[model samples]
Target: MHTLAQLRAGELSGITRLDLAEGLTEFPAQIFDLADTLEVLNLSGNALSSLPDDLHRLTRLRVLFCSDNDFTELPACLGQCQALTMIGFKANRISEVPGAALPPLLRWLILTDNRIENLPTELGERPYLQKLMLAGNRLQSLPPSLSHCHRLELIRIAANRLSELPQWLLTLPSLTWLAYAGNPLETEADAAALEGTAHIDWSALRLEQRLGEGASGVISRATWQRNGQPDTPVAVKLYKGEMTSDGSPLHEMNACITAGLHPNLIRVEGRIGDHPEGQQGLVMQLIDPSYRNLAALPSLASCSRDVYADDCRFSAEVALRIARGIASVAEHLHQQGITHGDLYGHNILLNDQGDCLLGDFGAASFHATTDNLETQALQRIEVRAFGILLGELLERIDSGLSDERRKVLEDLQRRCCQPQVLARPGFSEVVRELRSL
Candidate 1:
């Protein structure tokens, strides 16, 4: 174990496995000579802009954890680490990944919370690859070649710009868990097509506990079962109340109905009744073991004040995860000409696996042929609320936020919080920029 003083002195020559993660601000370049023997290097939670150019000299390196850095682009030289198996690059400024530059031995590639717009075809050629976590990238489409990875067990492409599900993905034999909630394909036509072809019996769903409650309605947990199959747990949201000074719950139902069945935006099973009390309610899939809301705690009693306070203390990894999830959901909604009137933290829910599922669409609206300036203004207010929530989370964490993340939040605030609704960034633009961040 190297002490703080030893790291500052920067004279560790034979260190094989270096773990300088917590409470570190800078990289100790003097220890670069250990490249010959170092295998596992954990330099996370640091304020570094880039890695040493000679970092590839560690040919024997395997597990490398350098997440939460300011590197705008991954060094091409990283391919030299042929022995590398696991790589963590979460919360960085990387926009494009060079597939040929990744190590062949890579099995677990964690690149969440980055601005990756596309994946290289070469990535699918890695025979040993198993888990590819690209939850928060801006990927509009994936390379069809990914089907080549026979060993891939999990591929988390949750938040992206995908408008449709590729046919090739359905044939992957080893894949058991597939989450693509924040894609535009969640629209009505696509959902119908998927439901017809996938043979997923969604009728046997039963509502469970209420997960969240908002001014417009309440969200609950649901379980769906088919004749001889096991029950599948889901998060179901019920929309209630009439159009108030805040917004209309009917508009939200319309958005969900129009947007269709997406995994990220909380799937709507069906609607109940439209009685004298207004539009009765809606049924949705349930999300369980719910985590704390990233932006703010719900005004509901189910969420304790202490839990909200603890959420405020989220680490950089957690914050990035939430941001990525929101961006994906926003992207999907924007593609469908819909806008979430309340995109704050309280509206977004996280699962135990750190996946974000947008709920409370009771305040959402569709961008029809004519853009309603009043509605747009209300949307901007929602964006501003999201900014305040992000700022509050950062303040509570009491840690240094990278300039990239800070700039992204500030831009969101300035573009969406304006008193004039027309001054706000369109839903699509916000989603794109956030994905890049």
Candidate 2:
């Protein structure tokens, strides 16, 4: 423990270590000068209000332990320390964190008990950040730019005030552990606003590959134990980042599960744990199928004219098959008082048996009442998406369609694409007509 007098007298010239724990209330500038060769500094358990602005001048300093301090703000010049890597500022009053205040080589940043409401987007661009702990903050949301941190592995942000989560957070391939609890957005009432639905049990599951990533959370491959047996493979859906209410993710998961299982619909098995990053994830029967997302698939415009023409040979039988499969799924969902908010080709999966499975329930809703306007509108939107998918698929298979087949499919597409919701035929009607073909 070096005192201010020793620092001022240059008595600590060769001091490579310093411990000012619980004894000092302010950082002495004189100590900063003698720390030119200091590599470790532990000022924890003290009432230090601020750090010396020129503290970064200690070019050889490597570790900083300032946890349990009274720091409301950090010195901006700390970024100049090219060699600094570990920083512990837990239990402080810091509300704002500028991107430039942190060095690029920083690997561990622990800021659990701060008033930080937001993080600079540049923080996510850091290449060396590995573990970020911002659990006890007043943060309302996270920046989508966090996806830039390819090396980030663990992010603990519990007890924050966030409403909705960003989608890109779920798509990060490197993220292995995440925690978001004690938020208002995770409440039951808040989730009820999105859709009037019931809760479903989703605990005791293990997650693997991500199936889809969205603004609210991520859907991944998971496994669940059945009837005291070992794990059963399934797909797990998890809320990605901070949420205002726990009910939002729960509502979506429950809706998907209660909507009942179908050959064309992804089946929900159960949930894993209670927290987002923990075992808490929705377990659904995995669809072992290939996805032909129209949005991502190569279009005829990208290929040579000859190749494009060769692939554009549309077959009526194949067109009818695709149309019928989609209609059948839509019909089932409608009968169960459920409406798929978006039903594009990307959400449709094709199994080995040539069956179509509807997925991506990010926007799905339930309607206990019959023919409600909201449900009807959702159905209309799904029809439009199905119509778009039909057009794209027909444009893919290389075969000319008979005039009769062309007329029928064109009519079906028209009904589904109609801007007037009432003009669109119900999914049942579409399926009946396709079966006739």
Number of the top-ranking candidate, with lDDT as the measure: 2
User: Candidate 2, residue 17: CA error in Å?
Assistant: 48
User: Which TM-score value belongs to model 2?
Assistant: 0.47
Name every residue pair that clashes in candidate 1.
Answer: 181-263, 181-264, 187-259, 234-285, 234-286, 234-287, 235-285, 235-286, 235-287, 295-345
Best by TM-score: 2
lDDT of each: 0.61, 0.63
Model 1: lDDT to the true structure: 0.61
Q: What is the lDDT of residue 373 in candidate 1?
A: 54
**Clash count, predicted structure 1:** 10
TM-score of each candidate? 0.43, 0.47
Q: Please write out the lDDT profile of model 2 over residues 344-386, one tens digit for every residue.
A: 5555665433456666654454544367554455456566656
Give the lDDT of residue 118 in candidate 2: 86
Error of 2 at 133 (Å): 31
